[model samples]
Target chain A: MTQITSAHRKLRIILWSGAITAAVLTLGLAAFRMGDDPSHKVTYTGEADIRSQFSLTNHEGQSVTEGDYAGRWQLVFFGFTHCPDICPTTLAYMGTVLDELGPKAENVAPLFVTVDPTRDTVEILKEYVAAFHPRLIGLTGSEAQVAEAAEAFKVYYERFEEESAPAGYLMAHAGHIYLMRPDGRFEAVFLEGNQPADALAEEITIRIAKEMRS
Target chain B: MIRTVLIAATLFATPAFADVTVTAPWARASILASRPGAVYLAINADPADTLLAVSTPIAKAAMIHSVETGEDGIARMSALATLPLAAGAVVTMAPGDMHIMLTDLTEKLLEGETFPLDLTFETGGEVTIDVPILGIASKGPVEATQ
Candidate 1:
């Protein structure tokens, strides 16, 4: 083989270096743009597209829709005042989380929607929610309204009869606390016994930080 | 009521075996006019047994119930006629799971009060437990010494 000339070797090296620089610059710019995109900032694990729309009555006897809670992060739970165990436990946990959040709690709203609206009237909800976190809003409406709300949130609830239960009826419902973004999109869910208040506070704090950054 | 109390006391005095014991029986405080509340406890039985029924004078009726989460993730409670306890098994009736439901309360259960409960077993016979009243937000039974 003939020996290569110095000029020919320099040309080959410059072309290869230029190609490498272009690729690196393109990838860097794309990653920077992705960081600026709000949708790509931080998505919660197990995010789903659950519709958030409903017309219900708040504990204050005021008619409310999802729009009433616009522009704020929301923590929503479905339960009834008549529920003895898990409902109260979750509400207390929410109270503790809010208390731990301190002033940052102002950026979030907690809602308790009654699965059994037949017995949970506005007055009853007002009393029930006040016992928990002062900022918690209790929502209840007619049976049809409550059903529609539960449906929109993908919440499962059914009232069944048990011979030994009061009036032979009790409501069986999912015990999940749903987190929604300020735009009312489903973000994540916390199972009843899985996450404690301190961990919940950390999650909320992280999400709020990501949102603020975005 | 007097006779029921006496029977409960006698039954509690003689446990069928040292291993068969009820621990940390507790109930949630029921609000005004609310007809039903739930009791949670832990039961440890050796040589196996079945929980046939539960009774309490403070309520019109009491029964065992278990909350099941469907594949769709909805939770619902169903009456349990008998709960089989495996040999050397420990069963916990806690929030969001199996529990003893008390209906038609004679009086509202107040926090800091202890009430009597009678549990009938298929093999271990019957035993009485003093269920303490816990706060509505309590997740588990408070220890007796605590």
Candidate 2:
């Protein structure tokens, strides 16, 4: 090979450095796009499995089941009636997000399932839910039935006695939104309080639209 | 009723309303003529003071409460004798959170209607405000974020 000049050597080094950097960056981007390699798949607890069923009562006191919302995409949130803070806030957010979806939102039902059936009776749920969105369906059942449904959806709830409390007892439960397929199959989960990279309505609309097309 | 007590107390009035001053109130208002609930209110203050107690004419007892959560995820709300409003601090009485508990309400709080509430402070003095009810009129002992 011809003898390389000092300037040529410097140029070669710079070129090689840039090429290597681009290659490494490309690899990193590809890895990130893979969304957690198989070896590192994230394990989420309390996820509702596919084909599970629960018997409950809707806010209108109508007997219902998981299959009641089969033909359309459904977003389900498990919360309690006594939850004055998080539950209503979540429902409000969910309502707002769904409302943002507009016409496409019609195919996606946002469900508010009560974990505290002891207090959130059919009538209570109707009044509570009516205050929010007209479409929002609040479902509740007996304690045992609610617990079974909660387990299937992977929710955690417990009531602590506050002997000194003058503001009635309080209940604490999980904050998670379950996105179910049109056929009532477990699809994916959107964790609460996550500021998603994309708008929730857009993301869910895309998923629902794609599922509808299929 | 708190109003009755206040009126009765004022009937024995001695002029010293200068020691306490409660102000800067924000909350929901009753916009309707008839409602089945109560309104919420919040306040802010500077210089340490104690919200000794609250009185309201709308209910038999209006207690100052703060939200609390237990280790097992149970949320509870209890009355507070004094909520310290430090210098440049803010106190809120919102839905599903810390609020002025109006028990055994006497009047029907509808949208557009304003009910009176009296809050007595140890240092900042006393303030009477109208808390409008605008939240869901449903039972909520389960969804606690204390």
TM-score of 2: 0.64
DockQ score of each predicted structure, in the order shown: 0.10, 0.04
* Per-residue lDDT of model 1, residues A1-214, tens digit only: 2211122111010001121112221110000010011222222355565656679999999999989988888899999876666687678878888988889999888999998888889988888888787999999999999889888888888888767666667788887888888988888877655555666788899999999999
lDDT accuracy of residue A200 in candidate 1: 77
The best candidate in terms of lDDT: 1
Task: Residues B18-95, candidate 2: write the lDDT tens digits.
Answer: 222232222232212122232344444434456777777766665666766444333455667777776445454544
Error of 1 at A67 (Å): 2.2
TM-score of chain A of 2: 0.72
TM-score (all chains, Cα) for each model: 0.77, 0.64
- Candidate 1, residues B1-146, lDDT tens digits: the string is 99999967865454443234565567877665464788987675655778788898998888787878776557787888888888656677877777787877889888999898888777667677778887766655332223
DockQ of 1: 0.10
TM-score of chain B of 2: 0.63
